[model samples]
Target: MKTELRVAAYAVCVRDGEILLARWVDREGRKRWTLPGGGMDHGEEPVATVVREVEEETGYVTEPTVLLGIDSIRRNWLRRLAGPGDWQGLRILYEARIVGGTLRNETGGSTDLAAWHPLDSVTSLDRVELVDIGVQLWRDRPPLGRSRLTDPANG
Candidate 1:
């Protein structure tokens, strides 16, 4: 009966015709593609968290050119057979430009590889939905504020 809220950041690292991404083998040993960022630490700014996370995950220094948008996911744990609203996460997406460093993976990190994937091929890859959102945000810079949507039932 406890709600767990997690605040995280995601970096859309783009260059040339490719996008930098972090790939990992999950606990089940399945490979997945994810953005180069993670949860924000205490007292850390979202921008700083994104920058640090990108470096840690991809070994590349980056500058946040623009904060694309925020993505929030809320799940009712009770309905999920766990607890009441016990799982939720908020992710802040930022458009990043790689300024330095080489492509490498962070040892002992969640991701085991870092590589650039073609933008056009991204959709074909098995990636999280947030990855598509980040690409859309990069292509279309939405309003400079919280962009939220409510389901019809919620409305």
Candidate 2:
């Protein structure tokens, strides 16, 4: 079987010891905080995709300063939000600096609100494992390139 691959870009925005995050409400009305970004569009550059996603999701104009690292995650189809289907995604993480724009909620977007949380208190919030990875990349940037085996399925 041919494995399907998806390419996504995400941004880690930090300022004043706080990290910017988007709160997404699931179908059950439970909220989860995640980085500001989304899947890359055809012919879109990774950096460009991150910039656009951040602005669209959080209303902040950001510039990706550096490519933090790439995460290759594999998960069962049923365990994913997309329902049962095997998935392997290559996520490009970026360290970004907010340059302009005011913060606003993205109406009709996947996220319900955007806010900054204390870096140390991020663990207290309900977040995905990818959030932890982004924080680590921001706190202690690894040697770059690709970082694999991130998802539990591959472990």
Candidate 3:
């Protein structure tokens, strides 16, 4: 068994009545919409990573105004190299706004297309969990710190 931890930063950009989203196509050719950000490089700040990733994936320069929250997911998978393993994903979600640049599809990147979808129509699209989480964060800016939930079974 092996353990893998990945830390990523995501941007939630909303303008007018639409939200910016990037389309991600999986290895099996399935497409799902996600935020315009990805994993942070070693020694890179979360803010900088979101800025670079947004520009790369959506062709727009953005400024992160607030850190909405952190979303973490842990799962088990079978990898060819590591065999059965556990992986945890910690996503730093931020509320950002476009500062400049024109809208264009990403090239040779994780996302092939970038588009703005009406907030009302988002529920109909095939999107990842991040989309919902991002929207919630955008709607309600939580406290500026970590949140802990108690488990009843522990009591």
Candidate 4:
């Protein structure tokens, strides 16, 4: 199988016990709440990527404070255009604070809505694994190196 790697950045902004999240709507019309971020542009710094992506998805101007950790995931899938392949995603997570802007839904973007969810309520929301990994890294603040995520299904 062919292999492809995607490098992305995500922001975790928490204020007043609430976490900012964006609603990711897939091609199949499935929706999941996720951190406000996405893949980086060529040559863009991860920090800059997260800042831009968060603003694009959540309508919030944020300043990243700390590099939380990295989360990686590998999965096998059959794509219509790429055919059968192994896809690996490397996500850089960062802790950020809102500097300006108001909460609003994205227009004609990957995410349709953005909102602040209670940290305690996030556990019950439909979300991607990256969301959990990002939050864990933020809360745990692992030192030394990036935190790696293992594929539970494969393990």
Candidate 5:
């Protein structure tokens, strides 16, 4: 089987009582809430990737204030268009602050909508596991730069 690796950056932006989120549209057209970030471009630093991705997905110019954690996952992509393979994802999480721009949905992107949701109600939304991981990392601030909670979906 082929082996593929993907490195991405995500931001956990919390203000007052809300957390910024983007709606990710998957291959099946199912929409799920996710952190405001995406994959890093070639030769781009993870910090730049997070900054750019937040702006692209949420219409907010952000500055990463702290490196929260890194979440890694591996899965078997049996139906991958590029052929069956083992895929590993390295997700870098950061605590970011919005510096400028207004709240607006992205156009012609992987994510279609962006909004702030009450932190208390985040678990009720249909969201990716990364959302939980990001929040946990932010809230706990584990010294190892990793979340204490394991992703059940990945296991």
Candidate 6:
């Protein structure tokens, strides 16, 4: 099987009971609420990637204040173009604070909308698993930076 590895960074920006999120358009053309972050560019630090991605997706200037955690997953899938392959994803999660910029949706990007959702309603939304992980990390703050309460099925 072909193998691939992806490393991405994400931010969990919560303030006054609201969490900032971006609506990501997946390969299947379905939209899912996710953190305001994405894959890292070549030679870019994960910190830099999170800052840049948050600005691009949510139009918010952010500073990652705390290292929330890292989530790693592996899956096997049949891709339409790349055929069957094993994919590994390393997702770095950070606790970020909005320092500047106004809220706006990203244009010509993987995500279409950016909005703030009340923390209590997040679980009811159509969101990716990363959202849960990020929130859990922010709440529990495990020393190892992992969420023990996250659903295994979601990963």
lDDT by residue (2-109, candidate 5, tens digit) is 998999999999999999999999989999999999998999999999999999999899999999999999999786477789999999999999999999999999
Model 4 lDDT, full chain set: 0.89
Model 2: residue 28 alpha-carbon error in angstroms: 4.5
- Please report, in order, the local distance difference test score of every candidate based on alpha carbons: 0.84, 0.86, 0.88, 0.89, 0.94, 0.95
lDDT digits (tens) for residues 12-131 of candidate 6: 999999999999999899999999999999999999999999999999999999999999988999979989999999999999999999999999999999999999999999999899
Any runs in candidate 1 off by more than 4 Å, and if so which?
Answer: 77-85, 144-155
* Tens-digit lDDT track of model 2 for 1-155: 33578899999998999999998777888889999898899999999999999999999999999988888888765544555676798889999999999999889988899999999999999987778889887777778544433645446
Question: Candidate 2 lDDT (Cα, whole model)?
Answer: 0.86
- Candidate 1 global TM-score: 0.85
Per-residue alpha-carbon lDDT of candidate 4 for residues 3-86, written as tens digits (9 for 90 to 100): 989999999999999999999999999999999999999999999999899989988999999988877878899989878999
| All candidates: TM-score | 0.85, 0.86, 0.91, 0.91, 0.94, 0.94
Regions more than 4 Å wrong, model 3:
144-155
Model 6, runs deviating above 4 Å: 150-155
Candidate 2 TM-score, true structure as reference: 0.86
- State which candidate, 1 or 4, has the greater TM-score: 4
- Taking all chains together, the TM-score of candidate 5 against the true structure is 0.94
17, model 5: CA deviation in Å?
1.0
Where does the lowest 10-residue lDDT sum fall in candidate 5?
146-155
lDDT of 3 by residue, 27-63 (tens): 8889999999999999999999999999999999999
